[model samples]
Target: MQGRLPNGTLIAVKKLSSKSCQGNKEFINEIGIITCLQHPNLVKLYGCCVDKNQLLLVYEYMENNCLADALFGRSSLKLDWQTRRKICLGIAKGLAFLHEDSAVKIIHRDIKGTNVL
Candidate 1:
């Protein structure tokens, strides 16, 4: 879901579903991992919430959405070859950082169209 901060910043809120396989431990791990990484290609993690039963992760909103939207015609904007190439390059750069450049060597277990933004 999309929401506005007290400071008027538009943010994306990821509320972990009750039926989701991921638990509180994994959520905390994600917060820890994302907080340590910084890259233009990677989505920014602004903050997170763990209040009683709710597990919400706040992220920087990307207006363009994700690659799945473009591929499956869910997006309004038509992507050109240049745009597609850039998307590929951006994903590659992000992976490179996670795989090599970062102090902690972390592998992204899930990499898919919907996961990329």
Candidate 2:
């Protein structure tokens, strides 16, 4: 879900999939973790929604969306080797920050090309 703030800042809203069965604790923890991290390669967490039946996380929008969409979507856009390598490097840097440089070590439970942007 893409949206813009009143100040015109673009953002992507992620709703915790009901299938994940994530409770409020997980949601709050995620927010806390995200807020504590500071890295260029990682998406910025803007805020979150915890209203009634809603559990949404707002993040900085990636103009290119995700890697899966670019690779599998019905688009003719072709990425060169350099672009792909840069994406991989960015992912590596982000993971390294989470797993090594951050104050709290974070082991990402799931990682997929679709999760990259």
Candidate 3:
């Protein structure tokens, strides 16, 4: 969901899918790990909500959306060689930070354009 903070910062809120097999356990684990991660290349987790039956994770809004949309979606944004290289480098940096630089090692099982932004 798209929302704005009181200070007017745009954000993307990800709510836990009720149909997900892993419930609160996975949510807590992700919040615990992601909260400790700090990197320029990574998406910033602003906060979360676990009130009553709601479980939502808040993230800084990405202006360009995801790589899949940029490359294939109806959006007319062109991906030149330089832009593609920059995106690739950014992804590499983010992955490197998660795998080797972060406090805990994280092996991301899903790595795809849809997941990249």
Candidate 4:
């Protein structure tokens, strides 16, 4: 779900299923990592809300949605070669930074189209 903060910042809210322990771990790990890291291409995680059973991850909303949507959506606007190249470059740079620049070496196991938002 998408929402706007009091300061008018758009955010995407990802709700985690209470029954999934793996989902819970991913949610916690994402929040912990994102709260400390800052980069231009990476999605900015604002904050998270953990109630009695529900967990919601609040992130800065990307105006264009995920890269998968831009590439494969029903939108008439098709991504050109140049735009695709730029997107790949951005993803590479972000990954490289996460691997080499951060204090902790991180590996994103779920590197798929849907996750590349």
lDDT of each: 0.88, 0.83, 0.86, 0.80
User: What TM-score, over all chains together, does every model reach?
Assistant: 0.87, 0.87, 0.87, 0.84
Which digits, one per residue and each the tens of the lDDT, describe model 3 over residues 1-117? 899999999999988766666667667788888888889888899878876567899998988778898889646688999999998999999999999999899988899988888
Name the weakest run of 10 consecutive residues (lDDT summed) in model 2. 69-78
CA deviation > 4 Å runs, candidate 4? 22-30
Question: Model 4, residue 8: what's the lDDT?
Answer: 94
RMSD, candidate 3, Å: 1.8
- The regions of model 2 sitting more than 4 angstroms off are 19-21
Residues 1-117 of candidate 4 have per-residue lDDT tens digits of 999999998889999788866665667776797788888878888889887789888988976667777778745547889988988999998898788987777776677677776
How many clashes would you count in candidate 1? 0
lDDT of 3: 0.86
Clash pairs, model 3 backbone: none
Measured over all alpha carbons after superposition, the RMSD of each candidate to the real structure, in angstroms, is 1.8, 1.8, 1.8, 2.4
**Best of the two (2, 4) by TM-score:** 2
Would you list the clashing residue pairs of candidate 4? none
Per-residue lDDT, model 2, residue 8, is 97
Candidates arranged by lDDT, highest first: 1, 3, 2, 4
User: What's the residue-level lDDT of 101 in candidate 2?
Assistant: 93
